[model samples]
Target: MKFRKKVDKVLGTSLAIIMGVMVINVLWQVFTRFVMGAPSSFTDELARYLMIWVGVLGAAYISGKRMHVAIDLLPSRLNKEGQTKLKTFVNWVIIIFCLAAFVIGGLRLVYITFTLRQSSPALQIPLAVVYSVIPVSGILIIYYKLSDIINKEL
Candidate 1:
């Protein structure tokens, strides 16, 4: 649990870096696209990938911090106790789904990448790089969700 606390701190820092990078890269892309009339070949794709990491990694931090948006349209019916139960159930479901995709879907993606030897059109970067992020994010999300549940119970 102590180690997890440290990990949460590290992840929090990563969240900040990811956000800054995504924002800066997107702004630069916009500038280059509109002002220079020549967007960098890889900026768009890179920004997209960065956004993916930002979103996925941010999910973990948000989950850990209990910062995710939850609409309680029926707040009277779904009080805090109900919300807590629902969140726990949702987190469990998320853990299951994410683990499945990371283990099964990730392997398939890796296999496809190696088999086809596909790369990005502009950057010629290995396509596996993008797909690999999916599994990584899944793993992180699972870890964070479980940690949150455990910490909450404790």
Candidate 2:
């Protein structure tokens, strides 16, 4: 539980920082384009990449809080025991999906991007750096879900 709380704090803080930077980047981009009459070259790409991080990390944060979107109709109708079982099953499903889709697939994507030396045109940074968030968020989600199971939060 302490570890979970720490993870939540770190993820939340990191997301907040990334969002702040993204907002500033966008504002700079606008200021440059309109006020300076010459748009900064890297701002757009930086903002886009920061957005990707914010979105992926935000999803993990939401999962940790058990605040992700869900249809509660079935669970609402279930008895306590039934709801517990259903929630556990759903948690496992989420874990499996994140492992397969985010961790495995994301690693492959990151590897390929690194191998090819793909980069954003404007920022000239490796694309793999941006894509790395996929696996990181996947692991975070997996950790949160496993914690849920272990803590019997279902």
Candidate 3:
């Protein structure tokens, strides 16, 4: 559990750094395009790549923070004992579905692209690099969900 928390913190920090880099890349692109009259073709591509990293890494951070959008009305209404039970049920359901969709669908997407040997158009980077985030992010979600369930039960 402690190890997982540490990993989550590392991933969160990496996400923050990637987001910062993406912002800086966009700023540079704008400055060069307007002020210097020399727009960069590669910056956009880099930004896009960084965006993938940001989103995947950020998902785990948001999950850890409990920041994802939720309709809390139902949970908010329950009595304390009922609420605890319902919360556990909801956590289990969430873990099942999230892990299933992310693992199954994400794997399919990556497999198709990998078999095709595709690459990004402007960046010329392999498609696998772009799509690798799917599984990494998915697995992270699975791990965190397991942690949540364990913590709740204990």
Candidate 4:
């Protein structure tokens, strides 16, 4: 419980900070483009990259809170034991999907980008850096789901 709280706090704080930076970056971009009559080169790219981080991290945070959208009609009709079993099965499925599609796939993507020396045009940062959030969020989601399974009511 303590660890979960800590993770939640850190993830929340980090997301807030990233959002603040993104807002400031966009404001500066607008100021430069219209007010100053010249657009900043890096701000657009930075905002785009920051958006990726925000989206991916936000998904993880939502998953941790178990606030993701779900169609619960089937589960709602089940008995308590059936519900528990279904939830466990669903959680396991999520873990496997995240592992295969996010962690493994994301790492492969990052490796490829790094190998090719792919970088954003305006900021000249490696694409792998932007993509790193995939595996990170995958891990976070996996952790949350495992916690759910362990702490679940039987």
Candidate 5:
């Protein structure tokens, strides 16, 4: 419970900060392009990178909160035990998918990007740095799913 709360706080803060930066960057891009007759190339690239982080982090945060969109129709009608079992099964499936696809695949991508020394064209930031969010968020999702399973009332 305590760990979940802490994770939630950190993730929420990170999302908020990144979203704020993205908003500002977009506004600046607009202002410079239209009013100043000059466009900031870096802002667009930075905003795109920030959006990727925000999306993955936001997903992890939602997983922690068990707020991800789901079809609750059947579960809602089921008995407590049935509902618990259904939720557990679904959670396990999600965990497995995250492990296989996000953690494993994302790590592979990160390694490739790092080895190739790939960098964003506009910002010159390492692509690996941006791609790192995938595995990190996958780990976070696993943590939250385990926490949810353990703390479930049913």
Candidate 6:
């Protein structure tokens, strides 16, 4: 539980920092393009990469908070016990989906890019590194799901 709390804190801080960097990067890009009349090629690509990282990591943080988007019409209509059961079912579904699609699929993609030595066009950063966020987020979601189920918070 302490580890989970630490992970949540670190991730939250990281996401916040990434968001700040992204905003500044975008502002710099706009300023350069409009006023300086020359845009930085690296800034656009960097911002895009940062956005991807932030989005994926942020999703993991959101998972820990149980804030992912879902239609709650059925659960809302149900009683407390029913809602708890529904939440558990939904969490299991999400866990399975993340494991299969994100963890497995993302690892495969990361491997492929790594083997090929693929890099981003503008930033020249390894594609595998950029894509590694997928599995990380998936694992985080899995952790949160397990925690929720174990604690019976759902």
Q: For this target, which candidate reaches the highest lDDT against the unseen true structure?
A: 2
Question: Which candidate, 2 or 5, would have the higher lDDT against the true structure?
Answer: 2
Q: What's the true lDDT of residue 75 in model 4?
A: 93
Worst 10 residues of 5 by lDDT: 145-154
TM accuracy, model 2:
0.98
User: Rank by TM-score, descending?
Assistant: 2, 4, 5, 6, 3, 1
Query: What is candidate 4's local distance difference test score?
Result: 0.94
Task: For residues 37-116, write the lDDT of model 4, one tens digit per residue.
Answer: 99999998899889999999999999999889999999999999999999899999999999998999999999999999
Q: Candidate 5 at 88: error in angstroms?
A: 0.6
Which tens-of-lDDT digit does each residue in 1-154 have in candidate 3? 6887798779877887888888899999999999999898889889978987887768767876667787879878888888878867877786777677767777888899989999888888888778878877877777776787788741
Tell me which residue pairs clash in candidate 3.
none
Tens digit per residue, CA lDDT, model 5, 1-154: 7777888998999999999999999999999999999998899899889999999989999888778899889999999899999999888999999999899999999999999999999999899999999999999998888887888832
lDDT tens string, model 6, 1-154?
Answer: 7888999999999999999999999999999999999998899899989999998999999989888788888998999999999899988999999999899999999999999999999989899999999999999999999999998978
Q: List the residue pairs that clash in candidate 5.
A: none
Clashing pairs in 2: none
Off by over 4 Å in 6: none
Model 4 residue 72 lDDT score? 95
TM-score to native of every candidate shown: 0.74, 0.98, 0.88, 0.96, 0.96, 0.93
Ranking by lDDT: 2, 4, 6, 5, 3, 1
Error of 5 at 19 (Å): 0.7
Instruction: Please give the CA lDDT of all the candidate structures.
Output: 0.78, 0.95, 0.80, 0.94, 0.91, 0.93
Better of 2 and 4 by lDDT: 2
As for lDDT, the candidate ahead, 2 or 6, is: 2
